[model samples]
Target: MRKSQIRNPKHRTENCPLSPRLNYFRIFLTFARNSIVRDMTFRANFLIDCLSTITWSLMDLGFYIFVVFRQTSQIGRDTGWGEWEFYTFLATTKLINGLVQAFFMPNCEEVSELVRSGNFDFALLKPIDTQFLVSLRKIDWPALSHIGVGGILLSISLWHITQREIDPAQLTLLTGVAYIFYILCGVAILYSLMISLAATSIWLGRNESLYDFWFYITNFSRYPMEIYSGDVGTPLRWICTFIIPVLIVVNVPARILAQPLAAETPEARFLLFFTPAAAVACLAISRWVFYRALRSYRSASS
Candidate 1:
């Protein structure tokens, strides 16, 4: 037998507790490095992928500038989501979505194929958590290019806001800190949602529509939630804000940095507190659902 096929017994001991957190971090780095090398080998494919992502993002921005921004100065009722402010919100959404797609989307989308081909059995034999191994095994470097575009958009918005004196007082040190923290929370919430959907593949056997379902659900999150606050959209706002919680992911961080609510208002206080709380709750629920799905998994050999 080739050495590559050999499994070192010392790699995993049955009596050992959970894998060391540091070991998981190292393993993740190894996976990312290998994926980068693989993508580099296909230089043409890599370039095409990168160009495609940048083109789509630019087109989306252009649509807003030429179409929507030309028609209205604000999205909400005098809430100040002007051209630059709304662009900042769009940039935040892109940054969050970019990270998720780069790190988790490829792996999550591959889950059904893994199960169907029995490749998941190898993942289960690994020392680390199966979900972690499966989710982080691949990184899409091209997808991450959106982060650069997002950063540029964000910088332009910040400069424009300062130059125009659009509530410059709201951009305080505290607000900056809160914005960063909530951006992280938003990312966490999105990751939780993606992984949970991926976990469903274990039971469904083949969930090829994962991307379609995910896009449909998260499409609502791309715009300002205030647009959904009218009589026709109030129920949607409630469901997304309280039940699903995806709307708050980008809204909180965007609002904090763009058009902040009055600190003295009850609604503002609720949103300020609810953003972090929702992150924690969503993560806990998703983790439970993932593990439960794993427990119910049955290998093809069985």
Candidate 2:
């Protein structure tokens, strides 16, 4: 090889075809590093954003503690969730939502703006998958504070459960592994929903209502799905659970850690096995939606 080729090895590697999965992972890491650097450049703003996220999370927790907890010990009547168990569930929600908000929300939210401005054309021209590039391009590091707070709350809740000997299954290695896996499943499901909603920007030209729609939909997932029982609520539960699958996003993993596995009803047991499959299906549907929307996109020049 010539001296010039040796000196510019990066050019060669860039041109060479590599494992698509590994290449995408590297691109994601690059995006993450760039986001961190960008955030750090505005240190004061970054700190304020982190503090704001933490405050909102604390306020949510306080509402449950003071008002909601005053009415009932568990989330719903006959739901088996005690005070600490409910806290465990809340913590799980925080962890899963935090991951989604940190890694995917910003990018997904920007899709509309990109589409409106016709900048999405540039993204489509990229060598990597447009969906992957657009979805993982931004990282909201401040939103990750929720995960830290969640970890702390989860530890405290688990410690109390162990001290009280409330849950017979307890937090074992298997449970821990299962908890983490399901958390990822929860994150995947939410990401799929958000990205699918965001992809509508391509057809709509501008989708300012995306956030509002997302908020209304995800509000259903925030609470325990079991609360959606009875004649009036049962139909809504079925729609959200089977049609949308948001109900299981947090409930499945949260139940694993918060409730005894042996005590789960047959229906709950079915959901436990169904959630991973739901996550996969959601992702596939989202991917299809994104590409289909892209097919309808019209360039600015055209």
Pick by lDDT: which candidate is best? Answer: 2
For candidate 1, the lDDT comes to 0.84
Candidate 1 residue-wise lDDT at 253: 89
Task: Predict model 2's lDDT versus the native.
Answer: 0.85
Cα misplacement distance, residue 55 of candidate 2 (Å): 0.9
After superposing candidate 1, which stretches have Cα over 4 Å from the reference? 1-19, 165-170, 261-264
Deviation from native of the Cα of residue 65 in model 1, angstroms: 0.7
lDDT of 2 by residue, 1-302 (tens): 33334223344457658866677788889999999999999999999999998899899899989998898887766777778888898999899889999999999999999998888878875666678888999999999999998999999988888778444446778888888999999899999999999999889998988889988998898888878888979999999988999899888888888886632779888987889999999999998898778777877745
How does each model score on TM-score?
Answer: 0.91, 0.92
Residues 50-163 of candidate 1: C-alpha lDDT, one tens digit per residue: 999999999999999999989988777776687888998999999889988999999999988888777887887765666678788999999998998899999898778766
Q: What is the Cα-based TM-score of model 1?
A: 0.91
Candidate 1 minimal-lDDT segment of 10 residues? 1-10
Clashing pairs in 1: none
